[model samples]
Target: MRQDAGNRVPDRLTSLLLGGALLLLPALALAVSPEPKTFRDWMAGCDNRKSCAALSLPPLVADTTAYLRLERPAGPDSAASLILRLSGDWKTPPATVELKLDGTPFPAAGKAMPVTANDNIATLTFQPADTAALIDAARKATKLSIAAPGLLAEISLSGAVAALLWIDEQQSRLNTPSALIRKGSAGAAPAAPALPVITARPASGTLSEKGGKALAAALRKHIKQRDPDLCGDDASPAVADEAWPLDGKRSLVALTCSLGVYNASNAFWIVEGNAVTTAKPVNFPQNDGGATNMLTNGEFEPKTGRISYFAKGRGIGDCGVAGGYAWTGSSFVLTELSMMGECRGIGSDDWITLFRSEVKTAR
Candidate 1:
């Protein structure tokens, strides 16, 4: 559930509906990496390294909680990992886990998987061989039955096969013996790709509370003058401005731009853009197909010099966008991020990880 951050290609591509036929367009690039795919009740996606995840969609029945995540790194010999979680009034964590495929016990006729408790969550581990067995079991199973302490649910396997197959194709494991669902002697999938590296300058410098308030107000006025449509009378009356030094000469500034009933958007820029330096907007990491420079509910941290934002799509907090960036001295770099596409009933706390990176101070 935690990752450095990734560019999640939109889950579903836009298709134009014709009178009687569906018109398809070329696959476009929304971000640097591949897009996540939706099949039935499953979502599958992979990062730059070919490491991929196939997750079970939430139940259609509102107010029900059941989720399963299958993750595997790219390579010919990779280990499979499974994380099963649920949200409900289940008093205590389950002591054992049991699974059935198509109403029949699998992996073991009647044996139960031991569960470990941690922070009120249950855990189940499986060996690579066991994972292989489960994948093989899923090939013909129509429904996945899960049982545990204070938890009992049946997750649809309708799209499970398609999702896993998609992952195989994405990781170049399709038709290869290494593939989870598809199998062939074609060859092993290429090694997992390395994550992109971002060398950032540690965040530094802080303005006095009064200086910060003053400069923030000034910047807000400046932005309003330059882009009235972005911060006009119709925009939020309240303004916010915060500054953090990226270097001795230039600093990063964030100011309030627009506001919604449930979210407030902030704009970021280089503090002193003028005859000496042109003030330009900084594009932050995003996956929700929104503006990068203007983040909703954005905040700049002085301690880490990192800026993060969370945009709630609704007041109930069922869905929205969330991400953080590190100052690279020259620009903000995406460090950690996650997103939940549909509000449905999925908790806001479980944004899917699209991209992740290993960041080091460039100094």
Candidate 2:
């Protein structure tokens, strides 16, 4: 049926809008895609540099403590690295482990796999060829088991496919051969982006014991007046407020903000000369792209201008948020930050790296 010019133009405009929306579907999905997304039994996260890592979690068995970390940086030439780490309460650490797929012995995949062992931790790094094969099998297999005489770690591959596919999506390798889940004969992906760098200024000057106490007290009073709602006095005042000299006229002070059973928050400030009125909260860069002043169980090192914070998830400190910063005279920059959202008995040092920077301190 022939239509009028006005009707034809409206129909054409609707068609164009729908076509554009179809083309933008993928980008729209990615725009709101959650970083550190959880896919069933697995968790995947990509850093700012498009360096993706997927962590595998084993079944919740007290005796079994092991997981796989599949990491690949964004680049055509970059290859995937798979590390299987095992460390938990056991009679003795296993010297080696055998691979199994769906309850069957998988010696072919384990052949020539590099093994590193110590008293507490044992790790196996799969070869590049084996890593490719392992990823292929894991995407389809139900379970991949790492077993020894007394140790066994059963990793469920429920969402292995999705997690790997998300990594490929984040790295723009969806249809390329570099993709872990989906592979095609597409051309090379873009090179890995350069890392962010942070230059640290060394803190100087000295603070006597009495001077430190007085500075802390003044800063505490100033904070109470400035942000009274923040750090109401808790009964646990045993942990004394601390102060470190940042420079000749400026000093950094930490007042015990709040205390918990397993964690403590410290309010930091930079005070100039003896003017406590000039004290302000330390503007620390946060991982989520903002500035914060609170640090949990933090301490400062004057020589290196380093300040670190470690908030344990539990008393055992198996999982939590841990990071450090390097002072840049005017502000503190985050050098590294990682988080273990789950307290799955994983070591504190094993948290997933979310943000990292090339830190350069004064020589």
Candidate 3:
């Protein structure tokens, strides 16, 4: 499972003793939309354009994956529903499963469905209210465990809060549906600070000498500290003629290192605050039978608030691709991609003229 990298949100919300009360609560109606926006931990999408959101948990020593999804159909929908999808791995599936949050039984307004197997899927459906309860439990608890006749597994509640916040942001519900999301809700979820606004500068036709010197210095420092074997000197004549401001305080510097005419590598870095930190370097294809990195010609678009780069295809007939990444508070996300005819050369104009396909996230 992929790990989330950021300051951990504390679980401070209090939970009600609703094990019995929830059984009598009614469901809440909700909506789903087609191709809705998504974050790292949450997804908002329609199986076709209604209001739906989903949270997936990394399994803990389980053979199958698990998902918690909420769906509210369009207008006049009586109630929203929460559904659980589990991987089927049992020989004799259980008829019911109980959920626990932080060692306490979680309230459920509806009964769990019998474990149905379709190929390898196990499904459980609950009334919309139950889904709301589960989401709330997740926010305030450290762990969530599912218990069944022959299965027992738990999920760490590390990313649950962010996932739910993403959902609320999409619907503009402001936590109206679940008390857990409200300011005074039992969870008492702390308001997350706004992400630093990263603005881009108007593209300058050329890179400044100061920027080039900074880039070369940063790369040499990185090589000396991280990979002395690949680079013998930090004073090599590396140049960064291409520079783009990522924001008022940060910049992106593109650089290339050539081993020879047949061996070369290209990479870029993010200069954060006033310091340049070690960055992940990308390797480009060389004529000397080496694996190639597709990313090149990195630039930041001020109007779109996105960083883009040219990417060449690996396969002989594959098209050239343009990739764009959006800045999340903590990291970058690949949110835009475009494909064109074969990339005969990284800078060939013919490739751009032969646009084939594109997909972009709705900003």
Candidate 4:
């Protein structure tokens, strides 16, 4: 009898193993199938340069506000190449522009450098060594002031640019203190408006599977031309029943969709109207922890106008990236995707799948 009982143990174990394998089959299929890449892949294909060309510099306006504009080409790297363009009337360049970073004066001995002044334009190029000092100075200045022999121009820094500069400078101070410096402000550039927040009625549309597939195909073609790594062999399609609300008015189509890198899943809702519209993703930090992606949940106010979304990528420990988006008339526009934290041992290649999508109607 004991021998018989012992034999049953093996049978039980075998059955359990078989059942487990059966359960894993669907997941394995999902992992193996091809999927659609992200809008980033599409944008990367175009001009990923984060220079003045990419920036929609506000229309030239005549205002007393000091203008300090920085330009740099965008790339998938740590530091951004900064081209500081200052415009204003200075009888003569200041003896020495004292730049403060995060409230402390940036170290000049090994960090800060003087910008080249041509005509009334003073240009400074920031290198790796000067990255930190530049970031620090930007952060410390609650009120950015340009002090010269008889020149004093003060302008308040705000919006995404300010946040970006502050973050860049802070990181520099912490990581590479020898890189970066604060150069003097440009004479009267128009103050940047606060970043726009999305607020709209929940959008609903009926997108035919055929139509959705066609749209996806067109977008994929456009995206892959620039980023060959996108979708790759794992491109497939999956749809959702309802649109994922970006805000009260605008919502992304999929609540949980397949993007080659990992499963993009989240719950979304709207925030305050006007000045501030925000949404948070629910399923963040994917199961394996390799899928570190966050997207802002909101859309533009005018339904037919522009749409925007924010995305952050982090996974595999210290490696992370941050950026956002704005929709062009036809497709979405990709903004800067800055590498933050330690981006080592990080795996790329994320994809997306849309199975079912339809526009909702006002009831």
Candidate 1 weakest ten by summed lDDT: 19-28
Query: What lDDT score is found at residue 233 in candidate 4?
Result: 26
The per-residue C-alpha lDDT of model 2 at residue 196 equals 76
lDDT of each: 0.63, 0.69, 0.43, 0.30
TM-score, candidate 2, is 0.85
Cα displacement (angstroms), candidate 4, residue 202, comes to 50
- lDDT measured at residue 29 in model 4 versus the true structure, 0 to 100: 13
Q: How far off is residue 315 in model 4, in Å?
A: 49
Residue-level lDDT tens digits of model 4 in 1-363: 001111110111001111112100010111111121111101111111112111112112322113333332222233444443444456665434544433454455533446676555555555655654454554444444444455444434433244343333333322332222323332222222223232223334344555434443443344356555432323443243133223343334322223324223222222222111232222222212232222332233235323333222322221222233333322233322332121212122211111111222122
lDDT (10s digit) by residue, model 1, range 1-363? 221122122233222221222222121125435556778878777765667787777664522356667887888888678766555546676788788878788667667878676654555666667777777777777777778755786777778888888888888888887777878999788887778777656666655666656665666666667766755444344445566665556666777655556666667777652211355677654334433576667787655667776656455564555666777676676775555555444554445656667777654
Better of 1 and 4 by lDDT: 1
Ranking by TM-score: 2, 1, 3, 4
> Which regions in candidate 1 have their CA more than 4 angstroms from the true location?
1-31, 62-64, 118-120, 232-239, 260-262, 273-278, 285-291, 315-318, 344-351
In terms of TM-score, how similar is model 1 to the real structure? Answer: 0.81
Candidate 2, 93-171: lDDT as tens digits = 6766788889766656344344677777788887777788778787568888877777767778888789889888888
**Model 4 residue 128 lDDT?**
54
Top-TM-score structure, candidate number: 2
Q: What clash pairs does model 2 have? A: none
My TM-score estimates for the predictions, one after another, are 0.81, 0.85, 0.36, 0.27
Per-residue error for 330 in candidate 1, Å, reads 1.3
Give the lDDT of residue 117 in candidate 2.
76
Name the weakest run of 10 consecutive residues (lDDT summed) in model 4.
1-10
